[model samples]
Target: MNITRRALLAGTAALPLVASAQTASGVGRRTMNHVKDHITRLVDQHRDGVAPIVSLGDPVLRQPADPFDGQVDDKLLAEFIELMQRTMRAAPGVGLAAPQIGVPVRIAVLEDPATVSDEVAEARHRYPLEFFAAINPDYRPNGHKRRGFYEGCLSMPGYTGVVNRPYSVHATYTDPTGHPHHKTFTGWQARIVQHETDHLRGTVYVDKLEPRSLSTTENYLDNWNDPIPTRAAQALRFHLD
Candidate 1:
């Protein structure tokens, strides 16, 4: 199915002044330090630079990630961000979360060049999004409007299911530079944002997917590769809003 290109499309910066305040308490400090050390060890263990992705059944994927405070110094955070970007690209996914790589921090990177057939692009409302990092990111649905499509994840390889998500969202997050951003995302970009942010909350698409819609990647490619999920929803006897 060339899933990486079809499914996954899925940043860094300096030491900012905010880390000190966010991690000021002794307990918070300790937690951040532990997370930092763990990340360091993971990086060191993967001499090849791309850390192996943790998959389903791994406890790390189910635990809510700690908020990114000054857990690691700016340099280390930059290195980690680069490492994440490398791993995500290697996974051939459009987005990746920290926990996916065994770092349980509220961070994720996402980008989609929107390189799909014109029919798919139009049907999916897919467009190109420049690569960027989202630290401590979150989102709210813009309205009741929703769309469903076959979704896949790097952490849950070889499977896809129909998951309906808000068509638009109001997203907020900090950039790698420590600056905060508030923006609106629509279409496929909104889906990508929600997917990655959900990871920080210890949620996966499967939790919300239509169970009957689950299919192996090969089957998805062979029988349900439509740009939209209408056919899958009907065949699977699931309702889509």
Candidate 2:
């Protein structure tokens, strides 16, 4: 989303500014440098418009990450930046994490695909995406209220599921640089966060869906554009006794 110049300036000015020296541990330094190089490559790739993809078999994609230790330098930070950009770009997605790419690091990036502001005419740019980073994240529903909708996953590929999610959420996490951040989200943003966090826990979207909600990929695509069926229909189904 085009944050008006005023909004962008205000947001930047509000950020906490803290710079720390990079620490030296032989193995850690090597790892950090490697990650940094990856980030550089990914950024260049993004500029060239080639999307990156992280598959389901990667080690990083399978494990949950530990909390950040705050010793990352430019190099380590760069690796994470590249992973985030590549995964999101390749999936034509708005969010992804290190665990999704075979790295066990506690990191993820997300952006809302619909970020247009009122001042910008929707007809001119109806869908504006904004990127966000989350390291060692924790997310949960803010209340008992929920909404049911269809969700898709990059690792799961052609699969989609109908699942219930909270209408809003409050999440906390560190940034690639080990800085703490918090935010609240609603609608699709909340759904994406909840979905990705499940991946961090080694769960897929299918695990969270009811049997009736499961659909073959072809059927899913066909019905994906249809409005959600009414709640009454969901409640009225009968099965063989």
Candidate 3:
């Protein structure tokens, strides 16, 4: 495939593909610099890697927030929307939130790259595997009614967790344009939505742990589900309580 000069230029859409190519080829100074730029932009706008809107132990993170109350305009929210997309696309992230990037607004985006099944393929022909976003959202899970999956978060960076989540969920939120919307999610998609939503409420994956499931970066990403059999330990830890 031709790497068009346009594609080579640094920006959102092309940067991801180019970075992937560079890594597959070989690591060099220039390629490394491009990777850094892509990762930095995705991590946070702040130089110090802290978000401005929600801080640790903020009450706002706990209380459910109202949908964008029709006051914030589309033009004004455009940057946050763009940041959300850049955040999710440039990294291994399946979803992202404004607070994690230091923007306090109730905004986030998600992408489910999984393939559709044969049963859903016909439906997908009409509605393919696409990206979605939720603004100032609320969700309900039927009492930990889903399978446990490995999860990672941008805020926690490098560290990941194996947490239990509802296999399915339903949520309501506004689009970037202030339009109210609702949808149901299941499987990996359900997990991503719940993970990012927690960010809006000032919580992290660490909070969803069961004590015995918690592990350091090395342990979680490496040993993973094959973790040394230690059933007596707490599965997870909550950063706050």
lDDT of 1 by residue, 1-241 (tens): 1134444332000123355565675666677777989889877776466888888899988988888877788877887888888877766778889898888899899888777899998998999989999999999999899998878888887788888889999999998889999999999899999999999999988899888998888777778888887887888788776
Instruction: Rank the models by lDDT, top first.
Output: 1, 2, 3
Assess each prediction's global lDDT (C-alpha) against the native. Answer: 0.81, 0.55, 0.52
On the 0 to 100 scale, the lDDT of residue 80 in model 2 is 55
Model 2 lDDT per residue over 1-241, tens place:
1112222222200122122323333555555555545555555555545434555566555555433444356674665566567556555566676556554455667775554455332322224337767766778788877766555666556555567777788988776665777888776667677776666666656677655765545555455323453442355341211
- What candidate 2 gets wrong by more than 4 Å, as runs, is 1-54, 57-60, 70-72, 115-129, 231-241
List residue ranges in candidate 1 displaced over 4 A. Answer: 1-26
Backbone clash numbers for all candidates listed: 7, 8, 14
TM-score of 2: 0.66
For residues 124-152, could you state the per-residue lDDT of candidate 3 as single tens digits?
22122367778777789845565654455
Worst lDDT window (10 residues) for model 2?
A: 8-17
Cα TM-score of candidate 1: 0.89
Off by over 4 Å in 3: 1-67, 115-129, 142-144, 225-241
Top candidate when judged by TM-score against the true structure: 1
> Against the hidden reference, what TM-scores do the models get?
0.89, 0.66, 0.60
